[model samples]
Target: MAAAAPPHTDHKLGTPILDQPQLQAGGGTAAVTEKARTLDHISDNFSKYLKSAYDDVNKRYDLTTKEGLAKWLVTEQQASQDDVQFFKDGSFDDFIRYYMSGSASVMRPPPPLDDTYPISNYFISSSHNTYLTGNQLSSESSVDAYKNASVLLRGCRCVEVDVWDGEPPSSSSSEDEDETAAPKPKKEKKEKLGLRKRLELRFGRKGSPPPEDQSKPAAASSNQSPDQGADMRIEPWRSNVSTRAEPRVLHGYTLTKDITFRAVCATIRDYAFVTSDLPLIVSLEVHTCPEQQEIMVEIMREYWRGMLVDLPLDSSQNSEEIALPILRDLRKKILVKVKRAHKHPGAADAKPSTLQAPSGEPQRSSSVVSTSTSSSEELPDGTKKPPAPKAKISEALAKLGIYTGGYSFKSLDQPEAKIPTHIFSLSENTLMEVHETQPAALFKHNKHFFMRAYPKGLRLKSSNLNPSRFWRAGVQIVALNWQRWDGGMMQNEAMFAGTAGWVLKPEGYRSTSDEATQKTAIAHHNLDLSIEFLAGQDIPMPPEEDDPKDFKPYVKVELHVEKHEERNAQPIPGGGKSKGGEFKQKTETYRSQNPNFGGEIIKFEGIQGVTEELTFVRYVLSALSSSFSNCNR
Candidate 1:
């Protein structure tokens, strides 16, 4: 009411506030001082105004109440028009920076764990109950731990978080009711008396003396056959189940296959905010048969997701703080933490590169030096000092995963039979068909596949098609067959075949004399691709090779391992014959690499400066190639 009487005056600067003659006469310095004073007063007013505006808009636009945050995400730093407008409506131009480009706020403090919010209280107080917090009792000789309490903390309305809680589950003898007889109605039906069930299923008579001691008691008592091995140690309740994940009733066998793949998936969806781009990668690595790698696809897939999406952060979550142990690189994680700490709103984390004045030998200075410094010092050369590089906040992401510790992917023992049929595809060189015409890669599923194939790469072709006559057109495809052997059983091998490879010099195609002499490898790696055009069927390789006119399209078949029979078809004297079988492709000389830490595959995109790891990998590879060339000779 008091302000309404006077009609509040706007004191903001740059809005015609410098018209005062005192400020005008004193020149720019005086004007700036006047503007600063006005801004200070207006800042307080603007803060209040913005807070009110934000409160109103947040209630209206927060989509978590309806569609769920996981169901929506913009891949590749992009945003929709509706979102942009929602931001504008919130008056971001007046205040908000539209951080993470309308994605993440500048400062999102972690919810205080012990602060007793209803959710926090649930996670904390439930610990008092004998409910497990997801830790499989890694130590302790007991099948006696409790199940997790509501695993609901995973799908928190806020950013999903997961902590090792490293806290072990406890055992409470709080059975809902005895299976032998119901004294009263129970709260939950998951209770039972173990004795009655054992007597009914394991024994022919109730309360019968066990058969275990009856016949062997006298001999067994005298020849106590020593303690069972440490690993074979078992507990009464779960001695038959698995020693990992759950206590197995028997030492190597699984306890209850109750925890299924779908159950694991639901656990994630119900608890974590899994992005649409990923849920799980139902991958299969064809190793030997008996020990097929059969993990719930959900478990293996989340390692990467946890690497990028989930942070080991219950405290501060930033792109940098996610310590994806699966990624084995401490340095990479540190750099990421630094970047995330920098951009995080209100996150007062230490910056990794807090550039200190570089040792003071030769240094630069800010040209905005005060007049005080101008009069006091001058160099003998009489030139003004170069301006110092003022620190600017950049949105560049710092990734520190994969390059360290070497293994970019995990190799599991899985049978090809387990790999969904949709994931399999014929190699481009093998030339299988969709009605016998289209090239090999014409199908897809919801996962990703990468293949390096040479569709039409050869050393010679009919002069009509081979305009240059020196280089023929045909593709070289490398197929690495990986089969895992577990003890005596053999698992179906999953094939990682390249759909194509590069065209190389004619001599290298026939012999290993001049291998990989400058060629580009073409690889097709799309996750669920849609090849619209039909490449058609592959005609059989033409037998005649002497005349350039009779030359037919041929591909380089690279088998990591081939059978003796398959090897005969392409024994070209100096190398394997080109008719159909075992021949490795020429090595590529100038293949692109991620340029940081190196291996056959680039760790990350972009040409970063080379590091020591890249040098080591190159040296090792060079040595291997040298040995192979020597053997060929």
Candidate 2:
């Protein structure tokens, strides 16, 4: 027809354009072209492509048809008219590239802050030995540690300060020289002793004679105060040999250096609320004398001013009956957590002092007190000796423990454990023991009161414990060594990602009803997850490597669930098997800088856990021939 209009050809290629509409017997050229275009668009299958690219995009956007997708593209992604048409007409490569190139976030947005709950019903980010930058045994201490934790890290609500008696500024003598000046024979004799012998020598043993230098009386005994004259035996591990009487912060019983308490307080005051306005908890480990303790109180009062929480007056209300204040009530306040001393027989009747709040009416105070004492020493003949006397807490420092009163954790059945304002501190080992043996009780107790778990004393290298284990048991504060950025700290950062370091415990954990407990007991769920490894673009060569052509990249995916003995011990009522372990999968290696995985899907089925909220998925992109690996959570 018109010479069968020479089959439409591309001039540049000099080839027949197969995509052009074919001539039909009864249809006009325009109509044929339009029909062929519509059929081609249908053949391209944009819907299927979009679904594969984003598995849940349609469900998330409430999209049913192409029109809805077009609207979403225009409104949410700010697509141009031409781009919208292109997307609708089956051009998905550009869209996938945009999404995979970090143009859109793959993670769910952080939930809004919910501060209406009781302070006990949240997991607070905390740091252990906040002043130490290296190992627990020997490290340089600095106030900058506090600033890093508070401002740079942004959301550390609890910090530990070990306050010891500081040396006077005018003191010229150095303990290092004195120790070095000791007879070489004495040093050799000390080193020859066994562990038990050394311990017996450090503490006063029943049969062992005291060291000659320590046995001698002090020159200033007549003028020394009672606190200064007390038998404060020097532990062999302590490197701080200062005899001055100012309050300083350091790791007790270790070679860690010291930072002035005033500098610490000032640093904390200046940076505490810079990142978050939530209440800050200072876990005061008081190793100072009463005089220095008073100096600490004065420095805190001067630096914190109106921000420090005042001690509540003695009240008729039972501490066990009162509940902890909500987050709203403690905003912008600094709460000192120290072991409260037992009050004198009739100290409740004493007149108000500057320590008490200005209000004349009585206010409730926590009934918790520390019951822990120094460990008993072993005799030379292996007989057990009585425990050393417990160190006395200064009254001034004890009174500074306003809202949170520190208590030595014994057992969940203890009477003090029921007090709302009482906070129990447990070492990582003890925490693990309790979690494995009594998870239900620990979870229930944490719902009403606060509990903190710190790294055990044996973590001399500053390694961190797995915080997720304690978190699963509903521990409110799992203090970690912030200096190490290992898996534990990465998990911590993820837990507090979108909040001000305080994440509300799950509803089942926070609820106190019997039904809620039952719900939490069997909260396990089975999940089926499929991750599609599509393609890679412009992958960089490994550092220090010579050629990009030698790169062979692959991705390994892992699904990790924090497993606990408690959850496995009690299975769900429906006879479901415990599925609490790790799942790993990997993709085939590709030999190019821009590797195309070609839609290889990795499927994880029957992945189960006590709670899905604690599950984590990790992806590691690694090279087959190289040691380069990039990890993402």
Candidate 3:
């Protein structure tokens, strides 16, 4: 029997677990053998069975030579009956199954529950198996917070406000302020002199000032001021100075200001984890002088593609496969991902060596078109030209429960293909194309697009554990754009992007109430949450004794849970005149003995995913503003 393993924390996730995944030891003779065996588990085969199936397929489909499969990767042409495919890393077969990417992101399973993001700060994933932290769930959550902040500022409408004094108009100089305030006897003389002086300074005038009559003293200015009978109502007018001249108005004007980045981040941080059904569309505001916003958006799109689309081709260094430099050169064109848009001919001018012909002949054609989009050529009906039809295998190369494709792809007996198995073209069936392979852009349903530059798809066993609604209490967040979802940006459908955060449920949540009875009880493994990060005082210490260095930068999230589902708080443990071991039996008990208590200890640990990135969108009245009894806004 295997020895019981000691309790250990998963290094990747920091979660406490009892599993010892058998990792291959490092290189040496023994380690090499172990590694070989491990590779067998992932991919091991001389592939005699697959080769036989391939022969049968060739005979049935009337294929005459190896040229019929020159386009296939080495592993693809010889996969076994049960071989799995995904991410272009697998065999050429349309009906393949099994995920190729290991798991979403590089994160380890969650640490003990107590070490997680504060439940207050992180919403429970629908399955309650993992979490998302950073920005709020919906783009609306951030938007609403921003609107609230703006409205509050409007309400305060402080008696005084600060606005930057613009670079003085070309005709004005900083030195003119002193010149104008020098107390000229005639008010007009002061204005005229300063305006002229500033203009002369800017133009680099070479002349000296006009001779002046004795400038009046302050007492002399009072008499020259508006006469009692004259019209004292001085209308604010265009100054008498020339159009090129300017007057510096330091104290009055309509002052406009921007929402700060820090405030934006705070607003978003405060509400990102509230559980709610509100729409979560995100608009990444790339405010570039207002005029360049559109260009900025384009740049962002290109950046995502450039970073993610090339990851896989960059790794396709093995000897037996056709080279795809175009696939590697992701800077080709930025196309919206809809329909067959992800497909663009790699390059028309480049050597066609990248795309292999089924005949093993290098495609030396002068023109080769990709099958992803409609042709650029226009037709009489105003319809764009359609793509060239790709060649396909006319018959299933597989037969009953084998690499031959005649039988249901899944099992010999579970069920027949619910429908025909030829929905894909022959090439589509043969090569397992990895969808989430590059952290490339996933999809942009509404205004927000989902992205991943790391890890892969995550498995969610159930969606019903979702919290019914999200509550936004204390976040100041930012959103660059906002619009009603035309196609619809539902909260639950938001992808976990590194830049944007989400707080929503999963789709069509399925209940994990119980599995179909298997006769033998099976234990489902959960990503465990460790409770060890709770070693410090539950509440913070008073300020004076607190040293600056001890301040932790993150918001410490704690899980407050019911003890044994309400056992009337372990009756005062100390000083009851009770002997040390008097309650030994009760103390050692796993469940509460109080007649009031019921149910078992929670068997599943709460798991969470942290927001690996964050940014300030805007700031507003934190929902926590009410908690301090009117201390500060």
Candidate 4:
């Protein structure tokens, strides 16, 4: 039996691997003899940087020589014999240089974005619950635990944070004495109280008292029934707790210790524009009192003053009708996504509603300052929901959300009503249903306004929705839980790895013309994508019950596009087979760790050019269910 392959470590996650060298020959098939010039012709001069980057990875290889260059190009580029021959012949240098220097893995750079398009026409990498790293019920909330870095370094352009009134208590001493005897630490308590005061001044205060008997002893709250009294006597002693004095960031009802919004702002300021130079969106769920609301705005102005994209109060552009500035125009800018102010009834410019709440579901108000509480049955992910807001957002906070306004999304039933210019967010459950019911309408809406989709409340463990589905529907910001490192998260990373945070929308999805909105007619042409499987290096082992000894590895390539009917399909069968219009691939079996299929080809016949452009291919390796000999049969 052959030995199991060691895990591959050379290629890090989010790094691009050139599995196949894209070679284009001008007229003759013969390898060119002239030495390829350095990549000076390209508009973006990254040649010097590329050379240095390659050297950092491979200290032993000398890119100037044939022997060293040949080895590096073949391994790094996954170059075929023709490519290797061309390299040795000195004609492949420019192509090699381009691959090493370009941002996109596919030889050429993607087309420049159309600045004229609305913000919704660009795909944005986003995250949910930027505070938590575990299940909602018990996850710890911290600023340092892979928080801002995911947005700054990991291609995540949008982040979400739930803001609540008052500073979270630092220790048990602040609680009522009946709950604990320990005295409060003065330093910690002072700092928290100070922060709360500042925020109160910024947001207006309703000056309401704390809930009655909040610090009452648990024993007192219990009924005087003997059974309840007995249970309280047996329960362990705990510290009495009180309401906070300032606004803090926290997950829903989870008793995870909270951090102030100041920390969140600091994180954004320090890391903003560090990774990709694109506009970063902050989706704020504000539940703070009016004073704290003002504080939130004040802090934003103090810390993020220069970088914020403040909308002009008297600007003639109606946010509901106009596209905002392009991303390049908003570099280093923080675009705040908050709820638009309540519209007056019978207002002269009152537009028809462009959205419909799901059938039988109550219509939620568009106020960010106020929101309806979810019943236990409707609570997300089995985690306890937090109490309703204690106060509405202040006028100051509402004014701060001018440029990048936010709205709660319903359904696509109301086409006449239009969403505001800035943002609209929906839970994954709501989005998937909308896609199923009115995919075209959803796509059309996305072209005009930014749409964000986040995980459903039921994802208690912080699982994520498939971003591909959301992206296909033209949703700009498909937020995922960055804390969980699942396949969904990995794929999300893959999609944004080499490109900037924003990717242009597909042509058909970019315009709202009836012809573009209609289903595109597929062009038929025989196309062959031949892959030469030299070997898979350091493939990971199978899980338990799948014997490592019985492993028969093969590769599968899937084309993500509209599925074509099998009736129109034609496949070239096995001994290495090709299946057009279908995603599955077949290759002769190899039992060893480095299984070399020599040259296996996957072909696609009668596929349209539009399908080809929108196509994204995924490569996966798996063990054959049966023994190698049987699989070959």
User: What are the Cα lDDT values of the candidates?
Assistant: 0.20, 0.60, 0.20, 0.52
lDDT of 2: 0.60
Per-residue lDDT over 3-57 for candidate 3, one digit per residue giving the tens place of the 0 to 100 score: 1112231111211111321121110011122222221111212133334544565
- The residue-by-residue lDDT of candidate 2 on 1-633, one tens digit each, is 010112232111111112331211010111132232232121123335555755565555544456766676667766544444344333355445344332233444347768898888888888888887666655678886676422223467888887766655654567777677756448778888755555445433321234777643455545545664333332211223254445778865444678899889998998787657788889887755444555676678779988998544334334334456778888889989888643345655555344434454222221223335435434443544445334446555566766688776678887567556788888866776776567667777877788988876656656677676677777888888765544455566557654566777777777444422323543677778898876765565544445777788888776656443346434223222221125688899998777778789999987766365665565656674332222223
Better of 3 and 4 by TM-score: 4
Q: Write the per-residue lDDT of candidate 1 for residues 1-633, one digit (tens) a residue.
A: 000111132111111112332221100111122232232122333345545655565455542333321122243223333444334333444233343132332222222222111110111000000111111111111111111112112111111111110111232443543344446535253245332332223222311222554323233334334552211121122122233222111101101112222233334344332211111111111111110011211232333334332123222433223222221121111111111111224333545232122242212121111100001112223432222112111111112211111111111111211221111212223322221232111211111121111112121110011111111111111211101011000000011001001112223222223222112111112122111111111122112223433322221212222222221222223222132212233222322111111122222222122211001011111211111100100
Q: Candidate 3 overall Cα lDDT vs. reference? A: 0.20
Write the residue-wise lDDT of candidate 4 on 1-633 in tens digits: 001122342111111111210111110110110212122243222344444555564466665566766676567665533444333333335444445332223333235555565566677777788776455545567664323323444456787878876654566555575466665557766566543343333333323434546422354564455544322321121222244355688764554557888788887887666555677888888776554565577567767878876654335555455455655577677888776553445553766332221243222222334433223323433334434444455544654565566644545543223534656678766675666566666767776667788777666666666666567567778887766544445446445544556776666666444423324422333445655554444444443324556667887655444433211221213311121223546567667555656556666555443244334455556564311110000
Best by TM-score: 2
TM-score of 3: 0.18
| Predicted structure with the largest lDDT when compared to the true one | 2
Worst 10 residues of 4 by lDDT: 21-30
Clashes (candidate 2): 0
State which candidate, 2 or 4, has the greater lDDT: 2
TM-scores of the models, in the given order? Answer: 0.17, 0.65, 0.18, 0.62
